[model samples]
Target chain A: GESVGLHLPTLSVQEGDNSIINCAYSNSASDYFIWYKQESGKGPQFIIDIRSNMDKRQGQRVTVLLNKTVKHLSLQIAATQPGDSAVYFCAENIKGNQGAQKLVFGQGTRLTINP
Target chain B: AAGVIQSPRHLIKEKRETATLKCYPIPRHDTVYWYQQGPGQDPQFLISFYEKMQSDKGSIPDRFSAQQFSDYHSELNMSSLELGDSALYFCASSPVLASTDTQYFGPGTRLTVL
Candidate 1:
């Protein structure tokens, strides 16, 4: 079975510094990608998403870059803050019949903001 | 500004007991998805429903079943629960008809099988 994975299990960054999290996926057929942030004891919150047609997308203070050739994805957060500390996951959207899409999440990376 | 809602913030059950979880999606969202997350693990897709019908299936076990209602809410039923079934269950929703719809997740229900 194809899987999505993160290169780093944990990441530490100083407050106000920029942070980057990387992910690798095995399925080339994946057409959409998303980044989610999960705080402790809560469900995942949608951060941003990009379709295969676009290589990069930007949200407020956050950017997601997708490299189709390498099957790689990365999330960059600017001005890291304590509230930004959480488990981040990258997900691939596998299209299904009738325009349905199923999300496959990768092993998450725990981001820590060092105040 | 409404978000997905789930019932029974927490549940405790013994082995072989049955458990039922409910989900209320955001208003006007027609598609619902269920996921399970073990400790320190990423969320795993279980199943999904679109317009009160099963839309997709994932690693859901035979002991579990789910359905979307006419009102667009969904429920997950687990029978003969085992200790390993303990985890955080999350429900998400999206409007499949939209071109750029994104799945928004609920706060989740914590199920503890004793």
Candidate 2:
């Protein structure tokens, strides 16, 4: 979608349409990546994930693409629905001390589905 | 499909007071993570535990500390609460066997510090 999606802030798409959200990361060592959706006043819900070795992965209506060359990640949602409106965040798994796994989350992009 | 559970969905405290937040992770999950989300801001990682041991630390303040028990449940204890501490706290759990460590989040606890 342009570049490693840096906090687009907001994206509006018509119902039944498709929209793409992008995220960029500087760490090439981050092997695992995840996409989470968070609604108002709610915790983040896992949507999909892709590893550094893979370029694309799909789940339900969501597709996550990883471009290791550019350290870019994008989530494509097909057939946007009303219930899909929420803040989307991209997180990369960066290992800490002793086999520890913690996610480094990017600033989210608020997606609004218009009817 | 059991999801993570967070206690006291909401909490209110006065400045300099103490607060305790608890999290019950999904069955068999070995890792628990905590995050803080300020109003209109993205979630920030606080800390994480693996197999009841401290695994990683993030931007958690000195007054905030957390631990995971043998049962895999975790608690976050905060002292000297400040108004700036008011925010949404989220807990996520993941099974160690999963290669991706896909975390499942529980409904957040909204804490208000007066």
Candidate 3:
């Protein structure tokens, strides 16, 4: 089955440094992509999203780069903070029956920040 | 800003017992989605509803069923629960607009089946 996947299972970065998380997806029909952050025992929180028509999107110290040709996506966080440490997941929105949009999430990457 | 709300933040159920989880979407949001996340795993889509209609289905088990009420709140009912049914259930809601496909997730309900 077509699925979304992450390049690394875990990442470690120092505070004040930049961090990058990568994801790869197989379904070309996907039109929307999003990044989510989940802390321990909590639901995923929306970080940022990018449409397939666009190549890049930016939000509060975060940048999402999408490469349609390779079906790759990356999330970059600036000045990594301790609170930023969590499991990060990337999801692709694919059209389901009846024009419904379904989100397929990738295996998350655990982001660890060191003070 | 309003956010998705989920009831019974935590629940403990015995094997073969039944459990119900409720979700209240943000105001004016007509679409609702349900997902289950196990320990150290990503969220898996269960089912979704659009305007009180069953819109899509995923890896949901036969023992589990869900529906959206007229008021737009959704409920997930699990019967004959098993230990594997213990997980974090998350509810998300979005508007019909395509320009904003971002789904807002609720805090989620933690279910423990013994």
Index of the highest-DockQ prediction: 1
Candidate 3 residue spans exceeding 4 A from truth: B97-100
By TM-score, rank the candidates, best first: 3, 1, 2
- lDDT per residue for candidate 3 within A1-115, as digits (tens), equals 6799999999999999999999999998788899999999888899999998899999999999999999999999999999999999999987888788778899999999999
Give the worst 10-residue stretch by lDDT in candidate 3 chain B.
B95-104
Best by lDDT: 3
Q: Cα miss at A87, model 1 (Å)?
A: 0.3
**CA deviation > 4 Å runs, candidate 1:** B97-100
What residue pairs are clashing in model 2?
Answer: A5-A22, A5-A23
lDDT of 3: 0.94
Worst 10 residues of 3 chain A by lDDT: A93-102
Task: Note the chain A TM-score of all models in turn.
Answer: 0.95, 0.94, 0.98
Model 2 C-alpha lDDT per residue in residues B1-114, reported as the tens digit of each score: 889999989999999999999999999888999999999877788999988988889899999999999999999999999999999999999989344779889998999999
DockQ of each: 0.65, 0.63, 0.64
> Which candidate, 2 or 3, has the higher lDDT?
3
lDDT of 3 at B85: 93
lDDT by residue for model 1 (B20-77), tens: 9999999999999999999999999999898998988889999999999999999999
Please give the clash total of every predicted structure, in order: 0, 2, 0
Give the clash total for candidate 3: 0
Query: Which residue window of length 10 is worst by lDDT in model 1 chain A?
Result: A93-102
